[model samples]
Target: MSKPNVLLIGTGGVGTIVAYGIDYAGKSSLSVVVRRDYPKVKDQGWEINSCNYGTIKGWKPAAVYESVSAAGEAGVTYDYVVISTKSLPDIVKPEVLAEPVITPGKTVVVLVQNGFDLGRPFIEKYPENVCLSGVSHIGSHNHNGVISHIQTDKAVISVFENPHLDKDFQVEKAKEFISLYSNDKNDVSYFEDTKWYRYRKLVYNATLNTVCALTGVDTGRLDLSGTLESVSIPAMREVVKIAKADGVELPEDVINTVVHSDDGDWFEPSMRVDVKKGNPIELEVILGNLLRVARELKVDTPVLSLLYELLKAVQFRLKEGQGLITVPEKRPISTKYYS
Candidate 1:
């Protein structure tokens, strides 16, 4: 059998780590889709200082495309297109981003993003194509084109097939991508219920990410300051209630599991990091969508709601400060939320 041809989009920390795994597996031919950092990455290559995989220096991809359109112009029908982009639907819809490269019946679109409902657009747009949802538990960061990853424990990836196509074909495709990262340092598991796992992961992100970003602290500091009990735990409990209302039976100890997970105390979540860097955060997918579901189900999420509002303020401040978005001037007596 020939090696699978894969196109990995968004070469950030997660994307770079996944790309390294695929390269290590040697089972797939890898290409990347990058934007502003394209020239730097393509020229300088990738230098990964990893805890689990050791040092990976000067690694270049088989091909690099500036955009999905450029990749499409290459005329290659990829077997798998792995998306590790931030799930910011407000910025760009997932369907539109993947449109240029996805071959409806042939390509498997794997989503390695945070939050819920991220794969909906892709599955809806290409019902014939298999879509896989993956929840990643890896600690990594990218700075000045270099990636530093600290795998405190084995990074776990739980992948499940979306309800769109043949289950068998989807499972087979999911396993093919799983094989690319199932080494001694990484563990990959398959699940039948995608929503359950997505909600489960949200329990961690919805609480820790939100609280950390709001307080401008790291996981360790939050825990040390007793915010884990005063804030994080309550927020996670709200997530549990929301998940239960959504018909997903998360374990009763799910909050405990998330709170006690060995995320290095100093480790900053992607959202907090983005806030610190003045980059757009994945506020909607992580908290906004969950809050919407909570409101629809009439599930009380006062803590989550408050965190959502505060995080949104922080996001607005950062975006405006960075000049990514403009803040409208307000009249002295304006009563509206935005003016």
Candidate 2:
């Protein structure tokens, strides 16, 4: 089979990284879409560096469009749409989302976003087009326009499941991505009920991201044995509890699996980084969604509830004059630290 064409959206870490991955495949036709302000990235010519792959330079796309609308204006379509752009419903804007180069057999939108619900935004717009839920644990970031693959987790692509996934087509698409990512160490696991998996992953992320943001620790540092036993482990178990309560089946070994996996610590997540950069941390994404789901399922998240309360307190402190969300734990040597 011929290598399918892929158009990657989002210009942040994953966008650049996915560009590099597709380039490495050396088979797919790859195009990247960034915002108009970020058009300079096109001039730089993309490159990716990974501990696993060492350094790979020279990833010039067939073309780079400023926005999806621009790409649409130019009449560009792909067999696969890899949406790695984070900060969605904000970054991509409403106008460009689900605007199709997407049609059955014409395009399969592989929604590779974080924080779950890959099908949420798309189902409304392109009910007939395939929206396959996918997540990437690959830790690569654009450093001075260079894509660096620091680590990778299990990359999952969804079955069309919601509206457009014919079983045979889903299987074929899975194989295609498996072959695409096969060159790299990570494998593309396919799940039929992508939402539950996505939500389960969301619960996992709820802890990982909020704690990382609240404590201001890189995931890599905190996942160490002591932190794992203390903070990370307990937090994750809370997430697992929510998943089970909601009838989501999370593997017993997922935390172990993620930590031990190749790209285990892909550096600080976007929210933590946002906090450091003096931007609003993504408390809404991690906490809001999980809270909404918890309400829907009527699941108790006492530990998560505590985390949520603390996270809001921190956010309020940051905006309500202090302008910062401090670490989750109390200071090491303050009177309030212990008491």
Candidate 3:
């Protein structure tokens, strides 16, 4: 049997890891869609220093495109389109971003992004297509086009099929995609409850990621400064309550695990790194959408609400400073949320 033709979008730190995993599996033909870094990655390939896979030098996909449009123009329908981009719904709708490459009933779109409800748009757009949601607990970073993965713990990837589509074919497709990440060093598991897993991972991301970004500190510093107990723990508890209100029963010790979990001391979450680098952060999906659900369910989330506001401000400032957006001098602002 021939290998599957896979198109991997978003070549960030996590994207690089996913690409490498697929390449290491050697069971698929991989094509990548990149933005600004397209030229560099296409020219020199990727230099990865991974603790799990060791060092990989000059790794290139089977093909590279600047955008989904270019890939679509190439007239190739991918078997699987794995999106490993940040969940910045405020900037671009997920459906719109994936529009060019998605072949409604033919392609399976797997979302490997952070935050919740990211798969909804794609699911809504292509009910016939298989949609898979994934949560990653991998530690890696990209510096100067070189990815450095810290293997302090086994990289855990939990994936699940969309509950809306209760079909055996969808489940099989999810399993097939999950198998791409199955190696001795990585732990990739398939679960029935994608929402529960998303909220469970949110317990870690909504707290650690938000606090670290706000304080401009690393996870180690946050833990050492007692902020994990005072701030991070409370924030995670709020997430639990919100999750419960949304009808997901998280583990009882989920808060404790998030607060005390050991992924390494100096690990810097994607949000913190994005803020420091003045790039757009995944504020809406991680915290903003969670807060919206809390409000809809009448659940109190003061800690999360505060984090959402602060992070929004930080995102606005960073975007403005980077000249990514223009700020009106005296325009009337609306209180409506991005969602």
Off by over 4 Å in 1: 152-161, 181-185, 219-230, 262-267, 328-339
TM-score of candidate 3 to 2 decimals: 0.87
Candidate 2 per-residue lDDT over residues 156-248, each given as its tens digit: 766646554566766677667656654564555766676667766664467766777888787777666366457666767766776777777
For each of the candidates, the C-alpha root-mean-square deviation to the true structure, in angstroms, is 3.2, 7.3, 3.8
List, residue by residue over 1-339, the lDDT tens digit for candidate 3.
Answer: 878889988887788888888877787888889886888888998899988888888889889999889988887878999888877888877778888888878888888888876766777788778888876667787777889888522333433455566567777787888787666667777777778878888998899999999999988899889997888888988888988888999988877777667666688877888889888899988888788788889999888888889888898887788787797799978999896
Worst 10 residues of 3 by lDDT: 152-161
Question: Whole-model lDDT, candidate 2?
Answer: 0.65
What is the lDDT, from 0 to 100, of the residue 85 in candidate 3? 81
Assess candidate 1 and give its lDDT. 0.81
Better of 2 and 3 by lDDT: 3
lDDT string for model 1 (86-154, tens) is 887877877788888999788888888888767666777888888888777777877877889886323
The better candidate by lDDT, 1 or 2, is 1
Give the residue spans of candidate 2 off by over 4 A.
1-4, 36-39, 52-54, 90-106, 152-154, 163-165, 184-200, 217-238, 251-270, 309-339
C-alpha lDDT (0 to 100) for residue 314 of candidate 1: 85
lDDT of each: 0.81, 0.65, 0.81
Model 3: clashing residue pairs? none
Clashes of 3: 0
TM-score, each model? 0.86, 0.72, 0.87
Candidate 1 Cα deviation (angstroms), residue 45: 1.9
